[model samples]
Target: MTFRPVKATSEGQFTIEGAGVNLYRAFGFHKPREFDPFLLFDDFRNDDPKKFEKGFPWHPHRGIETITYVLDGEVEHGDSLGNKGVLGKGSVQWMTAGSGIMHQEMPRGNAAGQMHGFQLWANLPSSLKMTAPRYQDIQGSDIPEIIDDDGTKVKIVTGSFWGKRGPVDGIAADPLYLDVSVPPNTRKVLPVDTYANTFAYIFAGSASFRDASTPYGVRVEKEVNGEEVNIRDMSGNRTLVNFDTGNEIVVNSGPDGVRFLLISGQPIKEPVAWHGPIVMNTREELMQAFNELNNGTFIKDQRDH
Candidate 1:
């Protein structure tokens, strides 16, 4: 099996979004080729309720599909489409801002006054850019989780793995979204579509997207679970590992284990004319979208005859 090499790595940067919600932006606004069809990934995990209480107020979006996964707390949301709901712990919301839509997401902390969540934006092919807006609200219990013999667990969110299908489907990008956790020192090989652009984002412990060229093996002077230990080619928390073309990936967990969100998607290689949340094919089209928004005509008919 061909193990895809690590194309690039980044520790991301801290930012504030949605009023005052502190967030760490993994990758967004720019993913030229290898990460095509996927635009943004924001990790909004915070313990301070004041940091997130302001939450995202009213916002407008077009030409993109946003996926929100809540690990703790709840988000009360309402959209111009007349949809309103609460996305509680472990819940997922896949909202397509096709044509145009205005929405607000208000986050309320859990009983312990903590909140954690992620927001990912996937680009749409030009053909489906102006399709009707849609929403896929998946509960935490409804999402399927598979466990392996070595205590490896995978929470399938939007794609299939090992004969089980994800809950969110019917999309133009055809993506695979998974949450994986491996026990300490465990090594696992996972298959990914050779053609899809894939990435793994480490959130909890440390892991090595180990290949033959990786430089990790013995223990080092690193603190782990109250002890100093070794980490073999381990990528620590809040890091993003993007892979090159191959059918599979290999990972080695550190002493504290590793938990991450792995995602892949088919690329849309067309010209991208982007302005804020509105993405189109040409610069002229982008201007048209904003001009319409200013003229109060942003929402399109979206009804196919």
Candidate 2:
């Protein structure tokens, strides 16, 4: 089994969104081709309520799907479709803004005034861009969590893993979203689909995703008697690792262990015409979407054929 190599790595950047929510953006806007079938990923995890209470006010989104996963607080959301709900700790909400939708998300911290979560925007192919909008809210209890014999824990948010399937299905991209935690000083190798684009976002602790021959912090490798030596440097918090084409991934956890989100999906391989929250196939289509929003015709009923 071939292991995927690290193509690039980043700690992302800090940004404020909505009315005034402080968050870290791992990737978005600048390069669409680099992460196909996925547009934006924001880590809105905060300890201070002041930085996240305002939350994401009413906004418009089209031609994309937004996946919000909460780990330590509550997120109350409402959309133009009259769908309203609250996402609690370990809960997930996947919303599909097929044609158009005005949405709002307000965060309420836990008892300790800690709010932590992530929001990922997935692009919809041109064929399904105008389809009816939908929502799949899965509670933390409903999602499957697997514990290995060696203390490795994995939460299957979407797609199948280790002979178990997640609760949410019928997604256009057929993505795999996993929350993984590896034991300290352990070496783990996970299998992945060779055809899918894969990446991992480390949120806690440190780990080495590259081979022992070429550890973290160093880009090049040196041959030590033509043998691969175990010299791994750990990648700490907020590290984003993008992998090259392969069917598996190798990870070596540090002393404190490591927790991260391992995500992958099939590439759409289409031209992206993006403008803020709206994404389309062509510039003309993008313009028309804004034009419709201005004329009060953006949101459509599911009955539209």
Error of 2 at 82 (Å): 0.5
Residue pairs of candidate 2 with colliding backbone atoms: none
lDDT of 2 by residue, 72-152 (tens): 999999989888999999999999899999999999999999999999999999999998989999999999999999899
Please list the C-alpha lDDT of all candidates, in the order they appear.
0.88, 0.91
> Of the candidates shown, which would achieve the greatest TM-score relative to the real structure?
2
Worst 10 residues of 1 by lDDT: 210-219
Candidate 1 residue 27 C-alpha distance from true site, Å: 0.7
Model 1 clashing residue pairs (backbone): 216-233, 219-230
Off by over 4 Å in 2: 212-231, 303-305
**On a 0 to 1 TM-score scale, where does candidate 1 land against the true structure?**
0.93
